[model samples]
Target: MPETTLRTTGIDHLVLYVGDIGRSKKFYLDVLGMSVAHESPRHLFLACGGQGFALFEPRDGASPETDRDLNHVAFSVDAGTYEEIKAHLEAHGLEVTGRRGDDRCIYFRDPDGHRLQLVVPD
Candidate 1:
């Protein structure tokens, strides 16, 4: 076997298909504290911890669907701020789920139904 020479860097951004870009933008910016990098009628770009996420509204007026094969997107958070983050999300009426096997992470869904996670180092 020959050694591969191709190399790739980390994730540049994540694009999520949302039903309503405005609603999704509000949820991300207001709840998650993400900053707006760019936006349009059908798209919104959010910046989180230097990474970017694009919320795209489909033209067909269909709701966004999650792929059961892929679980969720996990964002890294400081261990000290974990409780505060949980509380903030809960305060916004978002249901936070704790994994049975992991105590250092919590899961929740965005307004568009995309699953997301906040995780701290063990």
Candidate 2:
């Protein structure tokens, strides 16, 4: 008999524990322009295509804080969409942190202080 089991589903959501929920929400919702599925003063969940992402305040005494790193959550856009997204994000006054001229990746940071990168996949 075949083993009875449940196949794992894709990512339900990516939870980002931040120092400030409000600031993180603004960056994801306003800066990145992701639609909000659920939101509150303490937490905010946004739709990222089929998956989702949740931003909330960090728990007490989780870990000692340090400077943000280059490793960040990445989004893949159409290669054609790079210029358009870049222009739109810049117009909103968000600085593109790491820009690769040859390759197609635009990097930035969220308000609660997390790095993010958008790449136009070849």
Candidate 3:
């Protein structure tokens, strides 16, 4: 028999079940500036750097609160890009909070109450 093992390539996408897809779409696309890969009434897929993130409406009875585990997810960008992105987000009325070490980051919350962050890699 051939080797039976798990071959991992890389993360294809991260999905978030939000209370409102429209709101999540705006946050991920407009505020965070992720490029849209696909969009539907109930879902939005965005390209974040080389990775991807999908936001969709939660099923009935599903609690969006469970997304607390995903409280934040960040993309690594050039150290110089942080300020630019931060300025853009702020200009659009997004609030940013938190920074530490040589790495600078911006923090904000999505419409469904999920926290997100963007970090500039060292």
Candidate 4:
């Protein structure tokens, strides 16, 4: 550990590259009901829990299919809401593909194959 380090509060934003802007826009903005905070020619910033959830397409020759991050994004939810969200995804024909060891957290993938999770506080 460093004696002095950067004082970070929280994530200001997160950027994810997707295959198509229109398709990812529909999924995050329409399907998941994330409200748009801002937009550009390619970037769409979503208002999520006081932080920015950004989705955009690669415009500078980077391929989203081959040059994207290999990880998942997780969001914390209340117990009841967690259950409700899982059910909601199921209603949309999505399968719960995995779970945490505690079982209070569930995992699934988005339309673009990005893994996402919802967890309840212990």
Candidate with the greatest TM-score versus the true structure: 1
Q: Taking the tens digit of each residue's C-alpha lDDT, what string does model 2 give over 1-122?
A: 66769766787888777777766666777766689999887678899878898876656736314264335788766445667777878887778865547678888766655678888665
Please identify model 2 stretches exceeding 4 Å from their true place: 1-4, 60-70, 78-80, 98-103
Please give the lDDT score at residue 54 for candidate 4.
92
All candidates in order of lDDT, best leading = 1, 4, 3, 2
Q: Write the per-residue lDDT of candidate 1 for residues 46-121, one digit (tens) a residue.
A: 8888788888887878666665425788888654456677788899999998853456788999876788988856
Candidate 3 residue spans exceeding 4 A from truth: 1-4, 61-63, 78-81
Checking candidate 1 for backbone clashes, the offending pairs are: none
Clashes in each model (backbone N, CA, C under 3 Å)?
0, 0, 0, 0
Off by over 4 Å in 1: 1-6, 67-69, 99-103
Per-residue CA lDDT of model 3 for 1-122, tens digit only, reads 57778787999999878887776777777766788999888788898889988887767757676546565777666545666777876887777787645767778767776777777665
Model 4 scores what on Cα lDDT?
Answer: 0.76
Worst 10 residues of 2 by lDDT: 61-70
Q: Rank the candidates by TM-score, best first.
A: 1, 4, 3, 2
lDDT to native, each model:
0.80, 0.73, 0.75, 0.76
| RMSD, every candidate, angstroms | 2.6, 3.8, 3.1, 2.9
Question: Which has the higher TM-score value, candidate number 1 or candidate number 4?
Answer: 1
TM-score of 4: 0.78
